[model samples]
Target: MKKITFSLACLLIATIGSAQQDTYVPKKTNFFSDVMFGGGLGLNFGNEFTNISVSPTALKPITENFAVGLGAQFNYLKSKGYYESTSYGVNILTTFNPIEMVQLSAELEQLRVNNKIYYPATYVSNDFWNTALFLGAGYTNQNVTVGVRYNVLYKDSNLVYNQAWMPFIRVFF
Candidate 1:
């Protein structure tokens, strides 16, 4: 009789403890409250070659460790008397932070490339669309990220570059 009563008493206490730990509902979140703005700037100069680019991005975190964003890019390149080109594009990017100091990212970009090439005695114009998918990993510190990215869609016939790799630094505020 005593054992039965003790079991019932313990069960009642357990139920009350669980009831006291009920979760509370959180306040509503605003869409822009956590948005971040950032961008990357690029410049390359040589005796006969110059390249400049600007990109602006907006990112929003949907979870503690993941974010998604969109960006726009404008690029201009000139190799004196050889070629002059202008590129404009839009991209979508995603980032995942597995740890506090590491970030992994992916971006899909599409660009319209317009070029003027000067031969010995003639000029040729070419216009086309180029697409690239870049995958990267970086060390992140504060608002800065430094990394190397690989273009998985790079082609030898692409007019922009001969290599498929690029190094980058990104900042956000």
Candidate 2:
């Protein structure tokens, strides 16, 4: 009985002597320094279809849950006997992160295209403009993100493309 009482007293004294302490504190970061860079690139080569596309973007995190950015797009496309086109555009981007690994994104883009049509007798050039609204979801790892987006406002005679669906990959630096 005496040994048991002594052990209990020692345990209580030790527990009171060693107190817990908070060891983790987050450091504040600068707003301008907290920026991410990413974009997408695509190239297709074949006898019937050949194209090159590139887009580069920069983003600034406004809050823990929201981010906004801007991007530029350039594309060159050619068909075997059809026409060749060069297009350029600018985009505004917005992204929301409900979780760490997933993101919801929206973009507004305005593009201008110049096309040269090849004909046996004569060649003609045309210039046009297109505007697109893209909405999609993305999966992001530490530094890479991949996603698919659809142009909700797509038209057949748009300056850029007739396809409504587009896949994208981005790397953040």
Candidate 3:
């Protein structure tokens, strides 16, 4: 029941985002002219821990206030001698700005998580896939947005994030 409602909502947003204006595209430009590329590179290192990630996204605007996009995620994590793992995935995204400063967004992310845990004298390895749907609202300027989003599918058993609510800062060029 809940999943059905969420799927419907996402379909509605995608339909809205695909309502093209068709007024600004030039005839000779490449397909990427109106496409926006964004995402981030992150690095976290301490004495005995390390984390690295690379995310790249591309979005195409159908109108001045609506856009749809996709992104790729790659992450590497190491906890000294405890464990080391890698996670990679892809995501779909959509954003709609009803007014100049307020933006609504929906993101569907699918990730494959690989983990290695060390025990007293043995270690275990496991691989699995995790999916998350995030609905968010944000304050936006021309190239940046700051906001918080909630994962509708979050549970205590999820190993990707410790909390269902997370803050985000997005900058696109």
Best by lDDT: 1
lDDT of 1 by residue, 46-86 (tens): 99999999999999998999999999999999999999999
| Model 3 misplaced regions, further than 4 Å | 1-27
Write down the lDDT of every candidate, Cα atoms only: 0.93, 0.87, 0.91
How do the residues 1-173 of candidate 2 rate in per-residue lDDT, one tens digit apiece? Answer: 99999999999888777755446778887876888988878899997989998999999989997989999999999996779999999999998889999988999998898998889877789998888999988898877778899999998776566699998776878
Measured on C-alpha atoms, candidate 3 has an lDDT of 0.91
Of the candidates numbered 1 and 3, which has the greater lDDT value? 1
TM-score of each: 0.79, 0.73, 0.82
What's the candidate order when arranged by decreasing lDDT? 1, 3, 2
Model 1's C-alpha root-mean-square deviation from the true structure amounts to 6.3
> For candidate 3, lDDT tens digit of each residue in 88-147?
999999999999999899999999999898878989997999999999999999989999
Measured with C-alpha atoms, the lDDT of residue 85 in candidate 1 is 98
